[model samples]
Target chain A: MHDNAVFSHKVLPFFLLAPQLIITLVFFIWPAGQALYQSFLIEDAFGFSVEFVWFENFIYLLEDPEYWNSVRVTFVFSAMVALVGMILALLLAAMADRVVKGASAYKTLLIWPYAVAPVVAAVLWWLMFNPSMGVLPFWMDAFGYDWNHYVNSGEAMTVVVIASAWKQISYNFLFFLAGLQAIPRSLIEAAAIDGASPFKRFWQIVFPLLSPTAFFLLVVNIVYAFFETFGVIHATTLGGPGSSTKTLVYKVYEDGFVGLDLGGSAAQSVILMIIVITLTVVQFRYVEKKVQY
Target chain B: MVENRPWLTVTRHLVLILGVFIIGFPIWIALVASTNSSSEFVSGLMPLWFGEEGFGNFRRVLTNEERVLGVSVSASWMMWNSFIMAMVIAVGKIVISILSAYAIVYFRFPFRKTCFWLIFLTLMLPVEVRILPTYEVVASLGMLNSYAGLTIPLIASATATFLFRQFFMSVPSSLMEAARIDGAGPFKFFKDILLPLSVNNIAALFVILFIYGWNQYLWPLLITTDENYYTIVMVIKRLMSAGEGNIPWNIIMTTTILAMLPPVIVVLGMQKLFVKGLIEQEK
Candidate 1:
């Protein structure tokens, strides 16, 4: 890309890149390589003994019910989170787009949640549905409905999903609003002049044009739901109520650290690494396509 | 407006108002909870209005030296740690990423593409994926319970590097030619021309990276073993699980509010830059 104008420095470029490269090698590449290596080795509970068992960890994971359950949990949680987050954000963004006044005010109010840490978001929701002194539970009691997330797996999943999705709405809303604003206003005016209602205009003109953004956000939101929501689940559910909310990532931590199943944990880490690589590749590919359009 | 639709305009405002309320409901509850006494929290549902204990809760949380979950550090100390960690990570990412991006964009070095790809590979290796081995590496290096441990591993950002790279590529080549003809060295040109031009981008990236650094939970949780090294975000979870009935909800809520305030202020204050960084980073 810089074929025309170039800087000729032999050692300077290396000097410039040294800090990042050292950190990446030390923190990222080396550890990832270790994970790959350790995934093939089964270690005993004690630190003394280890055995190389190629593909045995993967085989064991394949046969393990908890691993499968975690896979199921991650998918279900991610689906619900992406769906709820995208829908709510789209609705709010559409509304914000239509408003002539106080649009920035609405944006300011809605976007602050993006700054709230996921764990803090979890705490806020946890306090709200705390079951003992929670307002939601207190209100639900009048309707003969229970709101305790402690004992109920479904309720626990719902809590984590809502907290995760709530934290993501601000991000999705910002993107959707940008996408909406980027669409030519003349298109909407022309559609309206043709007697198309606002609903028809949105679907026929706006929505289709916003597909690239929506697609990009779908990938991003799913990746976020997968990797970033670890804090939400950790702070709120701790994968609680018989591992009901335990995602694959959580299980990796639990198995590696708490359960001390290093082989299995490493195997899980390898799997997670593969998933991230796939998602990153997909995002880059889609981004390239969007650039072309 | 496109068409004179009174009902449509009214509906838009109504929907946006409702959206704002739904989004704000939990924070309102937290705020209200932070303002009430422990007895008030135990009596029933939390009060909707602020109580007399608001200042007291914040003061106690900030000053109390008692250990919660064996973390003897006060909330203020933890917040300081968080502030340092966030600032370091944000500044570190920006500095290193800009340098690397500049190298990649301007210099034709050996293994340049390889270096770029190596950095790109880091995008797939988040802290969560390689926690055990990374922890072992950090532990082996004896970096635990230190600021370096908390911020360094997380500082190598592919997104920031790529962003700067994109921005540099779009910069006019004639500017560089002009500088070169004026006998300006690469470093001088970078300092005088590139740095000034990149001010908006740096600010935008700072807004994003600061929030990112501030919001980090899992990494800090893994690296820090000492109470002195605890970050505000990491300690909040521990406080939540300190004890079910023993939790000082008011203080915890106050701390949560405190922990959230800075980044929220940054986002609100630099709205334009934050938005620009976010959209451009994704691109």
Candidate 2:
């Protein structure tokens, strides 16, 4: 996309582009290159010696059960978050679209959680589900149920999923609401006049029309759940209870920072970068398709 | 509007109210927790209403009147650090993005496509993915525990640049042509016409970027070892892990509220621009 009328200054454009280019090189490209280079080299204990190893770190990761566990955990976590968050947001958005009064008020109230930081959201949920003096645990105790994320792996996953999904609801809700409002009203009216129940009309007409938005949000939510929820798990669970809740990103941090495994962490970083590139390509393809339509 | 369905309307209202309650429940609990004293949580469930200790808890947390876990940084000081970080990031990103977008759109120079692709490549390299090396880079540059380390690396992303580029492409070519015919240089044209035309977009991007900068957790946590550079968001982890046995729930909750306040206010106060910026930037 180029503008026809232009300035013919040679050095001026470089001056304009210098800041962004330099930062991209120093902070983004160079670091990424280092990760790639370091992934191929292994550092020994005590930081004394370095050995060149091609794919050994990746091979080690592939054979390691712990790494597999993290992969499975990340999948489960992202799937749960994207599924729960999108469904709840869709339900709320459908109801919000139907209401004729105080719609803006409801919209305002619902979307503010999007602004809350992931760590802050985690703390809020942690306070609620705390086993000792939390109200929810107290209420559940009366019903003959125990709640302790501290020692329970499944309960810990549940806590992180809830907190992460809670923050995402507002984002998905905004998009779904915008999608719903964009459909021509006459289509729904015609379906209703043809003796279709509201439920039938929604499934037949509205849901199909909303699929593109749904697909777009699915990708966004997956990326978010994968990358952004590190803080959520870090603040509350720290991927604890025997590494039950450690996603790939958290595993990288854990290995690199806490465990001091350089090559392995760099390899993990390389893998994550590949995932992000693939997702970015998918997102861009969808945007291009939307443009074509 | 299409049919006479009074019962359906009532159901919609009921569902909406319930949804709002579920969304608000956690924050309500956090607010309630911030109001109570530590001893109040010793033997009972969390209080459902306000406690008499609300004002004192907030005052104590804000003023850093007492030391907890041998560290006594004020909530106010952390918030100020957060504000400064957010402001520099938002303004820095906007200014940089605008200049790059302008150069790409209005002028065709050698390696223009190369520069555009270089910036685009960054979309695939989030700070989370390359954390260790990025930290090493910042450390090698001696930017650790400083505002530049916290904000500059983050400002390198291409989302804002892409948005400005899209907007610039939409501007009529006749505006630039007319300005050129009137003897206006590139700088004068940009300052007089382009800057004025971009106010709405600048404001919208500012809102989104400010929230983004303020909510950053892992980057700040990694680089900032100095207590003075701690941001409101990252400091919560320290607060949680500190004070081994007796967790100061009241003070932590108070800090959580203070951390959440600015971004929530920004979102609510500028809901329209925030929504528009979000949807457009994703494209």
Candidate 3:
């Protein structure tokens, strides 16, 4: 990692690194340590008493049905988001990559949604599905079905999933498009010269070449769905309608902030930290392999 | 590109057109809702056309101070808070990360690798995972309801530092050697040569970080109990929950448009830099 030439300094380098180090220690490290430590203790809501019950929190969480439900909900939410978001983005990117004209224009239209906040996205979808005044429900009523997310748990999950996935499609599309462009043109043309049909060439060459990007996006999208979809849950469902839409991250907020269950919330945080660390490790390992290849 | 068949070209255009339409549908609905009067949304489906109360809704949402439900501040005040928070975060991250990255790249020091790893650890610990403890720390420090509470904790970014480090590594060693031969000290060389070269990276990072800071929701929600300190993004949630039927859909949509306007403008106006920043940071 060293440069061929470098400046020699003792105290100055320390000073240069001080601001970032200090902020990281204070905000990130300390809080994470506290979460780890507090997860072992059970205290009353008012902070009146505390008992060092080392594994009780973990044991209780393991046996808790609601916690298990949250895990199931999170998996479903994350899988749906990753699948829907990546498929739409892959389809659009493949199309945009094929067209020689107006590519940038199509990109501009497709990518602006990346800038819209998740909460705003949730609000947009919420407005569209608002049973009475919403356009989608109005159309649903025109058919034989009724559409109300407020009362239907499955519908609540669907709306949150759509809103979260919709905001992420732009990001995935950019990456996939970049990946598609990076594929050597000669390889595809060579395939074309070998009497391979367009669909055959794509399946045999382009799709296989795009797998790395697909895997990377899969990890990124799942992490996003797990953590960043907090806004989507907060704005639309609040994990409501009998906790049908409550993901793990949302449950942590609910139990910690609103429910005032400190020990349980801290325990949940530790679990989330483990999940994030695993995902990040997987991402970096794959990224390093990609670099080598 | 290998074979330009007319039918293939038509199919490609059709697929892209349909994708654009689906992507644009929600936004179009929001736009339509923002232009109409609230009364129009009482019993029927939302109108697709603009109504007579377009500017009236925006003006009321922007300047009106009367309490609707949970909103205690005007839309303009919330927007201002959001702007300040975003600016400080974007600038603070660049300055701190650049300095640290410079240290890691150009100089030799004790605990250098230790510092780098420590900073890298922050990337794994996002705010959402440790929200309760972080809130407790901020509360104990009495930083709640203050700009410092809103921005400082969020400014310590591992991704920004990594980006700057990657950029600094690519700079030629000759520049530094020449500057050293010219008797330019570290600060002088940095100011005269390094900063100028880093302008594009800084601009790209600024656009991405600005959107990131502006769109923060849960952190601001936890820290800012005072209505005056509420950011536009957080305040909108309050507006949504306050008055079920009494909440004006038009005004809420107007606030949504205003909230997303700055970041959207930055993305569209600086599309290239944004794409560069986004892709580079991920790398």
- Best-to-worst DockQ order: 1, 2, 3
lDDT value, residue B149 of candidate 3 = 96
* Predicted complex 1: CAPRI docking category: high
TM-score of chain B of 1: 0.97
> Tens digit of lDDT per residue, candidate 2, span B82-187?
9999999999999999999999999989999999999999888888999999999999999999999989998875999999999988898999989999999999
Model 1, A1-293: lDDT tens digits are 56778888889999999999999999999999999999999998787999999999999999999899999999999999999999999999999997889989999999989999989988998888888888888899899997779899999998889998999999999999999999999989988888999999899899999998898898898898888888888887889889899998899998998999999999999999999999899999998998998
Candidate 3, residue B85: the lDDT equals: 97
lDDT of each: 0.90, 0.91, 0.90
DockQ, model 1, C-alpha based: 0.82
DockQ of each: 0.82, 0.81, 0.80
Instruction: For residues A1-293, write the lDDT of model 2, one tens digit per residue.
Output: 34559999999999999999999999999999999998998997477999999999999988999999999999999999999999999999999998889999999999999999999999998888888888889999999999988899999999999999999999999999999999999999999999999999899999999999999999999999999998998888989888999999999999999998999999999999999999999999999999999
Error of 3 at B26 (Å): 1.2
lDDT value, residue B223 of candidate 2: 98
Off by over 4 Å in 1: B65-70
TM-score of only chain B in every candidate structure:
0.97, 0.96, 0.96
TM-score of chain A of 3: 0.98
Give a tens-digit lDDT track for model 3, residues B1-283: 8986899889989999999998999888878888998888776888878788778778877886355324667888889999999999999999999999999999987788899999989999889999999999989989999999999999998999999998988888888888889999989989999999999999999999999999999999999878899888986787788545665777788889989899999999999999988888767
